[model samples]
Target chain A: MKIALPIKFVIICSFLFLIHQIVQAQDNEEKIKMPESNNVCLNCHGHKYFSFYNENTEINERKLMNPYFVIDSISYLQGAHQGHSCIDCHSEDYGVYPHIAELKIEPKLTCVDCHDFEAIATEVKKSVHMEAFGEFFQCELCHDPHSNKLVKSDMAELVRYNNNRCLNCHNDVDKYQVFTSHENPQLLVTHDWLPNQALHFAHVRCIECHTAVTDTADAVHHIVPKEQAVKNCNECHSENSLLRDKLYKHQLKEDRSEFNFYKSFIINDAYIIGANKNYYVNLISLLIFGLTFFGILTHTIFRIIKRK
Target chain B: MSNTKLYLYPVWLRIWHAINALCIILLGITGISMQYTNIESPLINFNSAVSIHNLVGVIIIASYLFFFIAGIISGNVKHYRLLFKGLLNRLFKQGEYYLFGYLKGEPKPFHITKEEKFNPLQKVSYVAAMYVLVPAVIITGVALLFPEMIIEKFYTMSGIRLTTFFHSLAGFFILIFLIIHLYVITIGKHPLKNFKSIVNGYHES
Candidate 1:
């Protein structure tokens, strides 16, 4: 009887140990499970004012003031990347709490991963923004992946946004003076000749005048320095002006089968004086007319002398 | 002076000539002003020059159509008919008369008639200018008017550039023709005789 009780006791103990092991295994599985959605991350990041403290400081600053911080989900939902998921950009073990130290590396995400980096880089490398900022000239500096409404935005609004970005630094008189003094203060003085100088400053984007004339506006990002800027007034003011192709649409005839020479006879809704003017044609006509007038005068003089 | 008055130009023809001449002259002035606008004190301001040029261009086109229609209907096109059978020989004779004979005070080789209003040289030059040059200028000018309507490229050059080139070239020829026409008209019995004929529909035969 004593031997049977000991064996039963051993069986009950083992059964209890097996049940405990199974429960422990289930708890570990639950602990390591991945987050269902980005909400886990956004829970802490979505707050506009949320920020973590620097290693040196214990106080939390506004996210905008913190250079290293997460984007607010509220603003991100309204951004150009609204359709994209956080994992698309994060693309790492950010699914886990306390992401690995590598996530803090410079250029944690590269634009060239999804874009034509070579073409964009070729243009941007020449830009003053790239030259002045050096290592800080990143896509995110000008274009926030969150809240970026670039492609579908109105042209005027886009211009305003781009120019305002420039004004962020330029409007600071002391900083502007420091920047300009090192470059050329004469360029700013040269703009004084323009009619309504203040209006131009207020309305026109700096790149419009500072950049080289290109076939497409997108290529205007290939900016040149002050020395290479277009100085000729006739480039924009004369007939056959460059602005004709740049600012306006050059619509070809709908019928492409046969060439019709008279296709350009329709009146434009708006006219730029020198852009559409056929000055070469007019000049040749005038020259011929002048030659005839003078020729007649000379001929008459010769005939009068012969008569005499 | 011969007192024999020939009714060469009709009233409609006279009116067309006057209007066409005015439009051409105005277009020339405005065109020059616009082209050389950088020169101080232009004949007209830049904006005014463009406005006048466009306005006169339309008027010229209208007058040209009227001239074409009226001449066809009235059988006045016969005056411009080129007799190609002996055209080269006649042209030579007319050329000799102008270059040498007229300077020596010799009489013109060919006389004006209602049916054969233009001389041999006049027939060739006027026919080429009116039928070829005038049409070319008008077509190119109209093409330039609606830049958005045409193909962007013509062969190697832009449509605008090509049209401008042809329009200018044709205008140059017309200007030369006008000068020569004025000079040739003065070669009649009196200096102002041809001018008077266009105004009054009478020419001394």
Candidate 2:
């Protein structure tokens, strides 16, 4: 028993000693390299000795100032156009840090890059503001470059300008009054003279009385030719509501030949009439339909059992 | 005929019974949670609860088809036939007893046998729920899911508003019935008797 205990002790000791040697050898080996920096700034900032350095030259150059491209450089770097460098916009004489002294070109808005003034001018000429209403003396008279106050697209700037200009020409009694006697009445003071004559002074105009614009898009409307002017008039006057409804009924007519293809919105009576009265009857029909289904089921089951 | 061990249910019936039971429990929990979102669900995520309810609905339908086919093939249509016969009297009496007599410690009006496990009242209610309510709920749920399809066809053929109203009303009724049915299940001989029968496909004598 003594011999067996000593042998067991020797075996356990040898196993533990082997584990200790392995652990000691592992501890003597090289330690693992830690990350030099934590954030994205460190990705391009590490040196050969594993110290932090601002090694990306492009990033360093961006921090420096360039004179020739001063405005372009700041705006380009600060805004979404930052990905591009100074040479992209300020082409020649870009290498020198102080940059070559340059003449100031006219500052342009971002919108001018996509727009051609000549094309827009043609459309503006045919607009209501230019024709019957000389509200805008010219298109540029109302529109400004940077602030863009009156140039909000498709708004009723024409009506506002027209009312102001009309009052300027009509505020005097000489132009409108015919009989100036005390007993006699002026035509403008007559109760049945007009509906919106006072409203005109309150900044309402001809378009408010004669033309009904749908949205902002229709505020700046184009004048159709005399023959085609009848089409715009048809909106207020319909032939028959039922006749319009029957045109785009998708049931019997398998083909959509008569359907308005522009927005694919079925321009039916619902869109025009703006109210639906059939909902109540439809709900009653559905309840009746559900009841009828249960009735049929119970009847069939009873009939089969009776025959059996 | 003389054998004491009556093998009344088959493996398919057992499976259908278990799945149907699970669907009922799932629907009861999820449907209640859906009605009262302020209440904390035993399950996490209300959307997950809804998903479980839909999945359980599909499982119940599959199990129902299986049970229906088995009922036809096994000549168990007689069992359902008795449901229609004297249904009103049975339903009224059972309803009355539950309302009044059961409170006085009176015995149940009907007994369950292997052949006629569901009494007249039970069969009628089960058949109504299975054939009528289940189909109505399924149809309405399907219509709700594909509203645009129904609107496209029914707008000119019918009214979309009416279809939507019916679908919503049926859903409301089904949800109400689901709550009442769960409460009624608790009123069995013992509170756990119905639960045990559903789980193990057997009821105590």
Candidate 3:
């Protein structure tokens, strides 16, 4: 009975410790500010060319030398989860020096695991990626874990940030091929019909044209098919530019208006040919044109009468 | 000798004028088309208009350079010289003739001369149009074409937007000038006489 009591007590203590560890793991989520990742696992995993020895085959294999296994410490330290310990998300089995082979297939953490992306998921349901890629279309494909940052510093930064994400997959034929089975898909050739493609790409985000128009900026997740994309120039060029809704939608919360009457182009810094029409300027210009035309018409009548 | 005509429009000047006129017309059409790109009822396809506008802009730069160099070399630039003394008085007289005196068949307030090709009003108008507005558009156009060279910001506003505003405004003024020019050409001896003078390089003095 004495042996049984000690054993039972030990088992109870272990169960409590397991629960405490699980609770600590969850608490670590909030504890991370700018994760430095002081985790001991980084000693090997953070190496430029990390590899492991296969004991079963008695072969010195570099299986972990694949780019996926080696995390670039510089970028990892700069990333959102920079403060995170590897085990915070990864399986505890990873603590083993020569990790068990099955640990590789353990359900890995995804962006959605931490982020409340229910709104985005709803939008993504309508995306071509959802239909074509299904679950294979992950956030990491567009947003590389290492370099990811929600760029909101300025308009220029936002444009560059947004464009870089799209080009990562779209511009690289090798990477692009992985997504689409279409033979020989070239970004330039595909966009040949678009005038000044370079200029458009540099200034605007790909999602401006590719995504479905919605009130929320998260509508970016709803990337429509190419055919459904905005091809009409007037759609963005008109006074009621769709860009005001899509690309610059982030700046909507702030008062973009300048000088009460002066808005649109001056504040946004976009002088879109047809989109940034000034009401007062247009009215005055047209009035002058009308007066000049009328004056010419009346003068012509007088000249005709004098000659006759 | 009194009946002898002045060879006002030289070969180079004629060629420059023809090209400039054609470019202005094309640019005006394309500019308006680009500004009001109605997909449903477009005057010109947006891409086509942009291509045409950009191409003409380049040509205008070359054409203007030719005019600038040629005018200085040819001494034809002397005609643009203005005397500010009694300039407003002369301008008012010229304006009165066009508005009322022309209907009454009164003599012209200022006649075209070899030394003074343009009247007081014409001199000022030509100087403002050629020296002021045209160069304004050209500068702004070049800045817009190569935006990297422009100032990043003008006050709180973007330099690009301000440049576009200036370019568009200059183009608008040019459009108004073009209409007035076309109409004024009909004011000479015969409706088509001024037009023929430009082509044939002769003007009755």
Kindly report the docking quality category of candidate 1. Answer: incorrect
Order of models, best lDDT first? 3, 1, 2
| Poorest stretch of ten by lDDT in candidate 2 chain B | B35-44
Give all candidates' CA lDDT scores. Answer: 0.66, 0.46, 0.81
lDDT by residue (tens digit), candidate 1, A1-308: 36698899999999999999999998777332223476656655555444565556766654542322556665566556766766777755776544677776735575667877676677788787679867566776556776565532233454577676556456655545544555334435767755434434543456666776766545567668867765554454454455444433233233232322123312322223344544444566568668777867776776778778
TM-score of chain B of 3: 0.96
Candidate 1 TM-score over all chains jointly: 0.51
Give the number of the best model, judged by TM-score: 3
For each candidate, the DockQ is 0.07, 0.02, 0.37
The docking quality of candidate 3, as DockQ, is 0.37
Candidate 2 differs from the real structure by a C-alpha RMSD in angstroms, to one decimal, of 25.9
Candidate 3 lDDT, B44-126, residue by residue in tens: 98878888999999999999999989999999778777778888899999999999988898888887877777777778888
Q: Write the per-residue lDDT of candidate 2 for residues A1-308, one digit (tens) a residue.
A: 35698899999999999999999999998643322221222222221222232456433322322222124223223333334333333343534323345623533233335455555455556654456445333432333221123322222353455444333333435422322223433436642333224432232243333332333333333433333332221221122222123222232144455423212223221221111223444366467657755654564454446446
Off by over 4 Å in 2: A1-308, B1-11, B24-57, B82-85, B145-148, B151-168
lDDT of 3 at B73: 98
Ordered from best to worst TM-score, the candidate numbers read 3, 1, 2
If you assessed candidate 3 against the hidden native complex, which CAPRI class would it receive? Answer: acceptable
Instruction: For residue A29, give model 3's deviation from the true position in Å.
Output: 21
